[model samples]
Target: MPSIKAALSKPFAKLIAKRIKKWASQPLETQEKVFQNLIKKARKTAFGRDHNFDSIRTYDDFRKNVPIRDYEALRPYVDRVVNGEEDVLWTGKPIYFAKTSGTTSGAKYIPITKESMPTHVNAARNAILMYIYETGNIKFVDGKMIFLQGSPILEEKNGIKLGRLSGIVAHYVPKYLQKNRMPSLETNCIEDWETKVSAIVEETIKEDMTVISGIPSWVQMYFEKLIDKSGKKVGEIFKNFNLFIFGGVNYEPYRAKFENLIGRKVDSIELYPASEGFFAFQDKQDEKGMLLQLNSGIFYEFIEAEHFFEENPERITINDVKVGVNYVMIISTTAGLWAYNIGDTVEFTSLRPYRVIVSGRIKHFISAFGEHVIGKEVEQALREAIANTDITVNEFTVAPQINPSEGLPYHEWFIEFDIEPKDESKLIQKLEASLQKQNSYYFDLIEGKVLKPLVVTKIKKDGFQTYMKSIGKLGGQNKIPRLSNDRKIADTLYKLELTK
Candidate 1:
């Protein structure tokens, strides 16, 4: 693998720098104008021949006329493209397919065209650059960068070979820089996903890694393995690392423990990456929230969270979004996805065109008993409660189950610990009090006597890991469901005896 410096010095980095500079200098109004113009052009190019493109001409038209399309809606198109449909979503040739795990449904094979590859690479590069800009350290020439991603090699099934996003990027790594990089293509290019992640764990300990990037859960698991292999603590191995970039899920639950493990406050960058496209990234280095890429090869739309499911859902444009209000995000991407509801909700941290925070997934909530407990609320309560406690939680999952005695519902928290609490009973009480105080609905559920006090289930060190393994899903790209909004998750957890 190539050295970190060489990888960052590629032509792509130069291109990204230019784009960043250009974006940074533009006025908000100018940026909006540019975004609108790009949207117009993309619409024209995408649908000009059939006149179907004109259907989304106006902001209202785009919102009202275009119905929300989910993964299922686009499944036919994705399947057709994979089956050798030449004129697919993008105008350029499709290099390969990005295999993704669809937990709610089944496995999904997404097409990653040549034109869209630059979007992912650029978004990722900008995310890192933003982190450096925030943390005030740029020259990582000597530090190693570890990416906890899927294996870069393709797996064949039923005569079709599928390469994941990680593999695709690995295949296209510039030849000259591949030698010094710690996780070389040979290490990342394993055909079996499990074997690849295991290899990654084995190789990660031998390198002088300075920047770690991956899903928060997998990185944590890797750290556990490192601790086992080296007989050293997380701080020892990660002390040299300057930053941690995590995405794909909320990192709030793991933040305290992660920082504790690293022994210092490591800079973090979050990204909103999807199989269809890279939607947004953390632009400013110190910013906790992500900035939506407004002028990329995509058009954006938002529906007020309160009215997202009204009979006539009113969609708002970028100019209409207000800071601190949650909205259901929609986008028309280069992948030919129109008004696609990517199952995520976001809130603007700043009124400017680019800044926003990923609130949570639309479906990743518990409202079984009219107590709507969202991920953000849970994260907030946990952070507040932990701030006052000596306990450290590495990972956690929350599910709502029926209370047989009352025939109502109650929430059960499954937490994985790095260190046992000094006073377990007090910790649980404090957590419950914090949750009740922070979330009004949860509070009502408890105070109104509809549900009993929240129960905490402390699991073994590798409880989540064991659960993942039980389901034939362990390591890279596989994560324990953070919020079990549906009955299936609760059922699955019950079957595995991971929950009480």
Candidate 2:
């Protein structure tokens, strides 16, 4: 039976669903309006003045006036905002800064202005509402919900508050769901991730946990802690826990392990949220990819990832996107990012309503021999290899071993497995077959004897965790890249002093 709250919310959920469908049906029109609105709003800002936004009458005009820039390229403008200048990037000073790391530029503070904050909060809220409207399972809405995230205790930078995007979003949970949210504010403020997870376990273990949300890797740690403490499968402990909301990494690789831990399959929603903007969310349970948010105050452009480095490479809008093409997604948002390259590559799975899947990172790939292998290829290969096998992986990464000691150079797979495969050679064959099937460049190289099949170098159990802890990135929105062009991570994995 549905709780009174869940029952009452169903009517509103249907309304939200209808509204989303209405806007999505005309993606290009919605996006064009958003683009015009963004330009008009930012006309008085410093960036707009510098780029002549008032005179920009078309997408081409806007493109010619503003160049595509990564965070490093835009740092100068951001510094002015960080130094407490109003009407610099956006209309007013940003209320919050979403701080992130793992880039060559160390820590990055992305602005979250008053106008842009609600998009982040509502994107998350709407994802769940759409799910409830479609599935009619609002019972989960009544039970306690937990979000495994960073410390919400933010630091003041100039006059603006600075924290992780997830942390900043924690401050904006809708009023109605406040009572149902878990891990009391005190426990959420714990700085250390391990300490936080333990505290979260203590706070959530006895509650009616219906919704669990976080990056899959961190949530796995929390579940392990619960299982260790109670000696019970997570599903048994929290029988009503049915819905999972996750982002930051693809959940396919971790799906088998999660289902095993929970002792059953559950419904899940994937979100594409970053410091810059909330780009997309899973709107349908049966859809291939997330529905791109065209009505949000963000204008999108995409260039083919293959030609991204070439000067004068083409940029296209939603109206020009085609299914199955890998594109480097770019944005001009209300947060004052003009033609900002967020570094993510995506593939369009559908064109009618603009569904997209995050394919890989623009800079994260292996082309040592012009094979041009990507993150999605490697992840898919690994998933194919372990399917229907006794293999339960802990963590995995792939890098080209260009200078292996004995033979021709090949890709080295550093896999940390909880349940090692009984037949290693067969697993490797499956992986090689999948890679060859997906990537034509890699297949051609293999056929021409330019490269060899990948080799698996098993890392010790808990090895990746130790490496992350040593480097001070053990948790909180941190994830290992599925593929790397260099040996930085590969070499470090070999040198880590292990605990097990």
lDDT values for all models: 0.69, 0.90
Report the Cα lDDT for candidate 1: 0.69
Would you estimate the TM-scores of all the predictions? Answer: 0.87, 0.98
- What stretches of model 2 exceed 4 Å from their correct place? 497-500
Q: Write the residue-wise lDDT of candidate 2 on 359-379 in tens digits.
A: 999898999998888888888
- The TM-score that candidate 1 achieves is 0.87
lDDT tens readout by residue for model 1, 1-500? 64556455555455665677576456354445644554455454423233344555555655544577777876766676667655545454356667877865587777665556788877876776555445446545356677777676676643445766765665554444355355766877665545665677788776767778788887876776677777877668756777788887788778877877666787677888877788788777656577777556666778886677678787767767788887888877655666778778888887643677777777777777777677777777677767856668877778877755555567877777777677767767777888787678878888888887777777666777777777777766666666776656556656777643
- Model 1 regions more than 4 Å off: 1-18, 21-51, 54-56, 88-93, 134-136, 155-161, 174-177, 191-198, 406-408
The candidate that achieves the highest lDDT relative to the unseen native structure? 2
258, model 1: CA deviation in Å?
A: 2.3
Tell me which residue pairs clash in candidate 1: 1-178, 1-179, 1-180, 1-181, 2-177, 2-178, 2-181, 134-285, 152-167
